[model samples]
Target: MLDLIIRQGRVDDEGPLADIGVRDGRIDQVAPAVREEARRELHAGGKVVIPGLIEPHIHPDKAFLEQKMPNRSGTLEEAIRNTAALKARYTAEDVRERAERVLEWAVRRGTTTLRAHPDVDPIEKLMGVEALLALRQAYADVLDLQIVAFPQEGIIKAPGTEELMREAIRLGADAVGGCPYNEAGITETRRHIDICFRLAAQHGLPIDMHVDFADDVDDPRYTTAEYIARKTIAEGYQGRVSLGHVTTLGAVAPEARASLFELLAQAGISIVMLPATDLHLSGRKDRRTVRRGLAPAKELLAAGVNVAISSNNIRNAFTPFGLADMLQIGLLLCHTAHMGSPGEQMAVLRMATVNAARAIGIGDVYGLAAGRQADLLVLDTERVADVLVDQPDRLYVVKRGQVTVTTHRTVEVHRGPGTRSGERPAAGPSRQADRIREGGVPR
Candidate 1:
């Protein structure tokens, strides 16, 4: 007997049909046949079953303030000003309510885990972390919420922030974070990052930073990514650090990019690309050629660095649009980063699922293989390729051997001339399945 069984599902719209068995909140077997009795069974009906998504970067404290105070110009500076004003008036109840709305949507969109960055400077006074901590515990059964004590306003620039960040970790934040570019200069920015490193080491937690989010990446002083990569190696925190919104990595001088990518790979650091927010808030000053504000994903991937995508904000000033969907983020990445081929599509999906998990050090415990946690999404589509274009039904979402969310899709062609909505005649598998080869539905 098993806790639950998922019947006749495909991994990525390819390969032979297989069944997944779950017992004790973990995947027990994944094979062509698993004839086992269980407390519950989900008839996948040939839908694609994927591991639950992970959100690597977000600001739960400043989510959904699009209408409260608007940034007329979608520039980064204006966003910071607008959000600072909003954060000043932030209450625990308000933050909790907004963060809950975003988290609920993310969960419904197939995210089982997320890393939320809440402001921890003196102005916010740890209110954001406190609210998210409470919400984390409340949603523990369904969502794994990890909070980052982020100094969004800068530490040296806003003296006394280091102390608050220390308190934030003591209050249950899982990681240390910083926005060093918000400081006075690159010199102070280095100190800002050093302070975060010291804190992460002090509290024994991972570090996630917001670095080098500029439209143009040429700087005579220094780029934050290079300094941070060097620091990761110096502090012996390789593989334990992630950088979010490093758009400058994409904009840097072409000659400089390769060296920086090699340095990042050497340090075993991960990059979380915020497509929605970065695309919106960047290049305000460029009228001739608008900047795309994206990292060099292809170059980074080729350099053997772990590059992931994330929904950074939900309807906030930083990003006036988002629904907490990693697929949506990945779709935007596919367009902006020119990842249109079938192999690229699989890589894009992995950015949201596997790479995001590795960013937070949860890859070993997450995924669809045997012995991994049973966090899966049975999407309602003939093949996995439709997941991005069709927004297909989320037939079932199983978390840890238990079903958490489920839905179905129904359509009809009304028997019109040459209409073909129903399954094809005498189909062992749809002809469309022919295109779905090597774990993909080829274009």
Candidate 2:
């Protein structure tokens, strides 16, 4: 007997309907009709079924800290300073509570995998890592949590951060993270990147870093993409590195930018675009016609470079608004990055699924096909192309063939007799049935 079966689901926007069979926590089969029975079954009713969403980068431990200390200047500097003050008072219980809230929001929104970059600095010490280690085990059934020991404070600028990062890895961090642009100068920035690469190589782990997060490359520290690319090639770390918020790349001269893109492609490094935080904290100095602080996503994809999108921060000083929804962030990118065409829109969706899986080093086993792990979503929309435009509800969130989250929402319009268009009806209480969820039917 199979574990579960999803019937009459459309996996493609222009393909025929299919049935998916799940058994032993993996997709057993997918065909025009699954010819076997299962202990439990779901009727998709011709709705679009997609692979589960993935968040390649996020800060769960420091999430929801806007209320504690706000960024009054709305600049990256103020955000960091404000967060640093708040981190000194962080407790295990406090971090756990806020982090759990973020996870619950993510699961309800159909996210099955997340890579959390918890701060590994002097103030927080190992508090964030310890809290997330427990969460990694507790939420294993519903989510695949990959924790990175992110040194938000520069390794050289902040004394003892390097030792603390090692301790975080010893406590079971999945990746070694860096913040090179936070250093005092370009020289320290290079040393910071060197230490991150050495740590990753020593431990046989992947590297994910925050680099070039400014409005322009006028600062030498923000222009380290080329240097990092060369280092990646020399160290033979191809396809094992990811860089977040390369916003400075967009400001580089056209001639230089093209060459940088080629170098990045040759290095096989993935670019994880943090649209929420990048758009929020960047371009602070611009006055008239402010620039959109974002990496050239369209050009990066055209250059044969792997690119993905992530939320990065939620309700924190860095990004004061987010619901932990990848689709919402994709739509935001579509608007800001000029990815509104049909094909471009589809690409944006992929950034949250397959592309993101590749960024977090889970591409081999994450997808919506037979032999892949049964991590998928049955969306409320009927067409795959409409998934982003409609912002439909995730009717069922399946993790390892088990239904972990289910959402049932309905809406009905009621009209009284003799109520004509452009005419006012009786002012009595009208009986209109509407069960709204998450901003009332997405429009």
Candidate 3:
């Protein structure tokens, strides 16, 4: 017998409705009618069924540190300095507690796979990595957590960080991470990238880095995008390197930017745009008409470069707000990136689902197709096109074919006596005389 069957679900905006059958933690069949019997059944009720959201880049270790230390200057420099002070007091228990809260929030919000870049510098030491390792095992059934030994501090300038990074890998870090822009100068930054590539080579792990995060690459240190691109091509590491927060591309000269796009596409590198943190921390120096410090998402997509969006930090010094919600972040991108059109909106959705899956190297087994791992979500919206516009609730979240999260909300709108027009009531019913009882949500 099948494990589960989700009935009458809309899988595409223009296609007919489909039913998905799950067996042995994998999708067995997806057709208009799943005829086989199942142990359990979920009624989508004509809602949209989509692949679970993937967070290609996120910082679970540093989440919710905004109140502890605030960045009054509202600059990347100050955010790092403020977070460093808090990191000094971190314990495994403390990190795990905060990370667990964020992970739970992410799962409820329909994130099935998350790539967490936990800081591995001297201040936090290995506390973040250790804490996340435990979380990986704890949430393995419901979430896929990929840990990166991220050196938020400069690898070359921060002494002994190299040893700490190697130790983090030995302790089970999934990928090698770098922050070349945080180094002392251009030379040290280049060395930082070299060290990261060398480490990944030694351990046979993928590479993700925080590269060129400034509003503009006026400083030589922030001009390492081309270098990293060439290095990826030379090392034959295509499709394995991911870069986060390269907002400088938005400010680069158009002609030069176009060339860089081609190079990135050629090297098969993925650019993960952290819109929440990027829009917050970038362009601090602009005095008039501040620029949107986001990566050139539209231009990059036209060049056939892989682009994805993520929440880099949550309620932290870097970004003061987040609910660990991918749709909220995607909607923000839709607004700031001028992607309000229907086609643009669909592209934004793909950035969160398909592009993100490829970014973290999980595309092979991570979609809604038959024989793929059954990680899907049934949203509380009927049409796939309205998924973003409606910001619908994830009524059901399935991971490995097992139901993980289910949300049920009920609302009743009661109109007062002699209500005119089709307008909604300004206030809910306050007195029994004006109240009307109804079941389910008001249409």
What are the lDDT scores of the predictions, listed in order? 0.85, 0.91, 0.90
Candidate 3: regions farther than 4 A off: 418-443
Writing each residue's lDDT as its tens digit, candidate 2 over 291-386 gives 889999999999888899999999999999999999999999999999887678788888899889999998889888789999989999876777
Candidate 1 structure quality by residue, lDDT tens digits, 143-179: 8899998988889988888999888888888999989
What TM-score against the true fold does each predicted structure earn?
Answer: 0.93, 0.94, 0.94
TM-score of 2: 0.94
Cα deviation of 226, candidate 2, in Å: 0.9
Best by lDDT: 2
Query: Candidate 2 regions off by >4 Å?
Result: 418-443
Inter-residue clash pairs, candidate 3: none
Give residue 182's lDDT in candidate 1 (0 to 100).
91
Which pairs clash in model 2? none
